[model samples]
Target chain A: MQLKPGGIAATIGALAAGLVALPAAAQQQQQDAPSVAPGNAYDQSASDVDALVADSAVLYYQEDGGRVRAVEAETGLAWTGADGLAVSGRFTYDSLTGATPNGATRARYDQDFIGPLPAGGHLPAADTRTGASGAYTAPAGTLPVDPHFKDQRKAGDLGLTLPARAGFRLSLGGNASWESDYTSWSWRVGLAKDLFDKNTTLSLGYNYEHDESKPITGIPMPLGSMGDPAIGKQRIKRVDSLVLGITQVLTPAWLVQFNWSTGNSRGYHTDPYKLVTLTDRDSGDPFFYVYESRPRRRIRNSLFLASKLALGSYVTDATARWYHDSWGITAWTFGLSEHLPAGRSAYVEPLVRYYHQSKADFFRNYLLLDEPTPTYVSADSRLGAFGAWTFGLKGGVHLSDRVELYGSAQRYVQNGKRFYRDAPGTMAKVDLFAGSRSTSLVAGLRYHLR
Target chain B: MSVDRRLALLALTAGTLALAACAHDGAAPHLKLGARPWERDVLARKSMQLAVEPALLAFDDHTYFSKEAAAGGRGFDGGGCGCN
Candidate 1:
């Protein structure tokens, strides 16, 4: 039987659920053993049972944006003994100003014959065009540019887990978010199991997500016939995912892990807020309007591997990932972390990461104002190929047995290749549609009540 | 049961009895039994182990989720969201 996206997700979810229940069965069998001495056995049983109780922890965080403030709070508990279970959950609030709530748009062309022709060379008659008379007579050149829209959003999540025994554990979780114009929900479940005397662990997981958005009322519709008008009002989308993984503890001081995951998404994938121009074939004039509804589906797959090793007094962690999707996008990522002790009371960790992605299938540097084209074309930056790098340092210091303090700082930059550049032949003239650079800092303290 | 099979079983049983008789010839050791090695250290450091630092792990989760492609310390690729 062929496995659809939803089917794969469901299968993985079922596997994870089964893994979570295995530990309870093992614990039951262990409890049936006969006792040797009354007092000693009773005391040993008390300690063993007490060790299975769950441990608890809490944390708070704040994220900074130029005009937006984002915060998160989380609480977690884990049982350590026979059952070996863990559960963690978190809630987040995000607020943004000068944020573009409305989505962005993009369009592309196979080839533009923008010759250095005189202004009076050719023009199209206004009456022959369907909408927006200006589009029929406007020059073939591109528009100057417009300011991006602003918007806001808030989101939250919760996660639960059961630890590995004989090397097995189960994980499950969900998240939801809401904005002025849109709402989304996602859920996931997973199971991990170890084999070969705890040397190799395998995991399988699945996720499902749904998103919907409503257009603002009273906004005037664009004057164009290139894209579907139905997209201007309401939007709906869905995605299902599946993941599989393997981990190996090669040695006492070395570990390696590998993972592969796939996702299939369907429905409205284009942003409604952006617009594209079409060019008249005969007159070279351009048309100005919005390209709205386009139904599309995507398939994404990824491979990731990471390793950790102890180097003298410090530990080093390294990871690499490769990703590809049906949208004609491919990407790679590399990251590293090093931890060093800062005297007896403190420790420091420095981290660096780099990422790069290729452009989407329909990505275009620019679109003409007046043009008639096929159904598929987009310029969304999220679909485009891009590269980014981030560097950060984190440190922690112990004040006493009950209290500790820690903090981190990070800087990020997006490479120019992420944007389009003018090239020869079939190479379209592309430019940076938009880009951002920022830094983040966090600090917090932990207190033990027990 | 066959005669030979019964005789083999009886001989095995007799040998087990002989071993048991020899074991009873010795008395239990006089030295006192104590806590397991790991248990002793755990009890000695009891005061330092009680604090649950939930927040620190939460911060690590968020940071790693947004920045790293491979997560789950044990080697799994996490889902990609709009958080980054």
Candidate 2:
């Protein structure tokens, strides 16, 4: 199905109508169970139907200066079976287009690029060119960008939950995502048990993922050197992670959750499309660019904690996370949100989050020709020391007994750390702190179908 | 303290709290069986959930994962994307 806004609503209405009757009959037959409150059929059915929710959302994301624009549509369906089983599925389609920064600094003259060469062919050297209308200028003192960047991706997920016993739940899931240049498949298993009268829950989970990336154009020459073979090939990366979590009901109005996780990734971790500018060792003048490289293995760990408290008609949530990686990066994240209800069918939530991270050991904006090339180096800004802030607001209204509508907007900004500098006296005086900003908006409709 | 020590301390604290609760009397039935009838409606409100909306939270997490350098500390983890 197209699942456009109108189509999604119509489809949901029909599907919900068909599915609602089965669950009601099942619940009525199961009213003999002690847990089913007598004469509270609506509440019992509501609780049962609440487990099944269908969602459709459209998202728009934009970066500064008309840079990258991404539009995505996502749909999800989750239903609980009568035999202590639940299944859920999700699918998302993303279309991305626009200019993206190419790791080169602003130059005194315009820069031009040529050809998407086939495998084993080198990228044409950057140069200035003349057009019919005279010199074609790309402008100076601004970040270099590849103007013809575009891609599309489709991702799907499936999950199953089974209540194996009185107090234990088991979950299994798999995911597949495919893009023009990349494909990934992952599987996960999780188990959870309730203790202390179901107030304390402990869970463990593990996941494994395998990914293959084949750059649409071709893999650049090794070490980013010129005149090298730009082979068209597929690179692989794999990750395995484990998680342990605990949730406790502290009081009638408060609850807390904690999670500890560890993971490791191996294989190609570099940005295939990014490169580092090489500068003259002594003069600090621009020399050339080379493809970025990164370590083959990465180990990471994180601890996260979250708490929720209810006060009258308002609910508040707070979370903190600490993360560290073998790449010599450490990060801290904190967030808070407050949900306030308006009347009986509407709610508004305001959220704010702050994140700060240390740079990887091999991160560099530009490499000096005088220094020996490291085994691993990258110019990707995400690997550098930076701080990010996100502000968001979301509101939802109940449109009908089975449908709810919600929309959200979020703004994110990342600024480089002030303490970072190239080395005392480099040839170029590049400003590494030029930050990036983006905004995202999402509109969604949810259906509680029995 | 080191991260390992802190983790140990937190685990110990959680163990102690659970044991202490187990030892205590039925002084707070509301914390055990269920909430009082007067507060049931409020407790059952959809907005009271930590995630509130699961699909929306999942989408937000995916966006952050693509843009940020961190991932996975929540209850469950899976899936990989080429957003980077």
Candidate 3:
């Protein structure tokens, strides 16, 4: 072979390298460079190449007053090849059922609505009315609801992560979701680079999403009467998002991340089933209930900061966010989580989060019948001023070397303040607050296939 | 308390946290501290990650997005859910 002389030279070089230790500068460079060990071709242990890592979870959520009930099952699978290439995919299925608010506050008198929803736009066709008549009534002092709310959603995402030139890792992913009334698809690309002795990372990502809505009840013109004929059958919404993030390790036991995200959405943003009621200026009696209206464009921005601290075997994470949008909505969120060890193979985490948001510019509790309807108006409670809190506990235990099981439960409570000016006398005693209380229960198993 | 006093208190609390964060950062951001490279085994633990539970984080994001007026603080991938 031609390597006879080169082989001898390489043998001598190996001996020289073994006889003397590397210089301090060389050692530092070696420390900063990423490891490419024989056993870690995929950046993990050799056994990971032979094992399929999968995570499966099931969650149930229910809101108070039977507002909404949902169950979801999700699974994620990952594979890493010896060539340092990785592929990951996720699948999710969820079924939702129960009554949902139709955006009208409870008043002193009973309210009647048409079809399975409170909107008159959902009226059955003349030919099918005999077999599929749908209507419901809200009792006195009760919030109007759509009792026939039911839907199933299936979603999936696939991603690839691979190393790029100049010490950067690039990621490409796409996601799609389908439901009876709505569908969405998105593609995202991301780039991340490590620096400062591998103690800091900078990342940038961009995503574009397209969504379509085909309401079974038909799409009505903005602010139009409930019984008006549908303006169209389908509407489309699109969003473009960009995110910049930085992760830094202050000490061996502390890590912090800062992220700034911005997005712009155009097209449909209003809920088709929601309605707003108009009351007479003199008697406060309900005069008309019409579909809601919203602007065609929205721009949003947020700043997020999170930190994790390791104290011995215990770990704690704290996060805070500031959010704002062109719709005149501002929000703040804070969260804290602590992971404590219980035994050799088990741990528990207690978490708490707080959120508060101000009312949107066009949010109206109720429109006045005597006055002209504003260009943009909505009674959806989510657009109003509200504060929320979440408390949760999660625990996990290793059933065996290859299996881990975990479960969590969390309670969410929201409180809002509703206000209106120049209301009629009869509306004085009505409860206008719109809020919700819900509970979430989740359980999951992670298995390593060999 | 008055609004001014409350604002002052908030500022003070934030300053205190900032100092604490910098105590190990050596007066500036992203600066290495006393811990040696080999001593970072604890930081390698999964629990030490910013968001340890990915699944739980996703669920929380979805829940808050549906409940609140403003969304999109973390990940940019989210579908338009017909939720109230």
Candidate 4:
């Protein structure tokens, strides 16, 4: 069932009551509380105490059923005339499919560094790092394939501020992903500078990535005669990217941001794990085959814009993005979000996003068996053009001064244009391929300590 | 050339600038150090300090970005298995 606006309101009311009751409980047990410094306790107002408590204890959790799960914890401590520091970290686990035979499982870890701006010290910058790994088994009865596939990825980044005279900050990062026979590595560095006395921020960045894989041997061909295969074949690919952007604060409550990026890729871009089939000219029968090798080059550009508005008691945010690539693909995305207070301490946000993309340059329905072909024919679904829409609802409830509960659910649907194929002469028949529409639900709770 | 000396010099410069700025701004009346009006009641409420921002977004994006093979979310695009 869908959660209507009234239901959201009721949930918020309950959260508000829960938040307000905590102070009452603490007051009832005040006699048991620890002693406070004589003048320090009275020097600060009640609101200062509340702010201190809120800033010290913060936790977050989210779970997407059978797809993803995550938890985060953070704590901050502030002293008079000294910089405030907050330490936070997150962990996530995801299982793409149900406990099916071909399901995949992935896990990730992240840490963030946050600190207050030094006196006139510009905005505080943060650093983050994440590592992930996953393994998946091919679906049953699909093709003669290996039992399973495994991969691991790790990334690290640093965000730092530059001197006001330099008018820029720098962000540097590196990443690596490896499998049994393949490895990918990437590095990126970016700079951002504010102008017009913080009214506008401009950023520029560059990135380079490389991938190398060792070809597998000793596999029996499905259609062709088996032969003693040559092993130790190596494949390599490289990608380079440059991005530029600017953000402007139109007003105290309004902002606009724009970004443009260009990317160039070269080398072996074909997937060795997937293949396509073509019907024979003489027999008119389909034969499954694999691509030997193919090298490709691609260029891509993307732009994104976002704005946020505050209305009386609610905040509204909107974002739009466009992307174009030399592979003959163009795509657009739009998103909207609204956050409303449920009660004194809790709030709920509803979000929706829509995305659409055009087809690739070499995407094909099928290939004729008799036709002389290029070096590659792939059925990788991501290369196809498609459109998808998602609707989601999430609620956040504060259970105590340092604890929170939250849950969210989303429904997604995709047009069956690129992935789903329609056989000739079948008006109502459609083939549901490996990629299809799906739905997810998530919920989790978190607690923090000072 | 020693690391300690370099750090000491850096600290001296930073301290000098900080002290100078504080001296110039110290004469100004202290803005009451407390939560803003909108934050006053919210902070007093329990769960106001709960951490939920990045974790929720990270999980949701991870699931869909990998499963649907869509792009965006938490930077770095394309790396894992192309199963989606």
Candidate with top lDDT is 3
Each model's fnat?
0.02, 0.33, 0.45, 0.02
* Candidate 3 ranges beyond 4 A from true positions: A1-51, A115-133, A418-422, B1-36
Model 1 chain A: which ten-residue window has the lowest total lDDT?
A129-138
Model 1, position A95: C-alpha lDDT score:
33
lDDT of model 4, residue A75: 30
Model 3, range A301-377, lDDT digits (tens) per residue?
A: 78788988877678788989988888899899998988886544556789999999998999987888878889999
Q: Candidate 1 DockQ category?
A: incorrect
Deviation of model 4 at A433, angstroms: 5.0
What DockQ class does candidate 4 belong to?
A: incorrect
Comparing only chain A of model 4 with the true chain A, what is the TM-score? 0.62
Note the B-chain TM-score for every model.
0.33, 0.57, 0.50, 0.31
Error of 2 at A242 (Å): 1.2
Q: Candidate 3's error at A116, in angstroms?
A: 11
Which 10 consecutive residues of model 3 chain B have the lowest summed lDDT? B28-37
Best first by lDDT, ranked: 3, 2, 1, 4
Q: What TM-score would you report for chain A in candidate 1?
A: 0.66
Candidate 4: tens digits of C-alpha lDDT, residues A1-450: 122456445544554554454445334323343233222121112232212222221122222222222222223232221121222222222212121111110101111112222233344222111111122223322322222222222322222322234555665555555444456677777777765445456678888888785433322122221122223256677878776666655444455566666667787665544444453444433343433233377666666677655454455668787776766777888888776655443456688988877766665444555676655444444555677787876665445445545555566666645222333322113232334355544444555343
Tens digits of per-residue lDDT, candidate 2, B1-84, equal 258866894776587456536533465544453233353454454665556767667777877777677777774333477776
> Total clashing residue pairs per candidate?
25, 3, 0, 6
List model 1 lDDT by residue over A62-128, tens digit each: 2223322233333333333445554444554443322221112222332121111112334322221
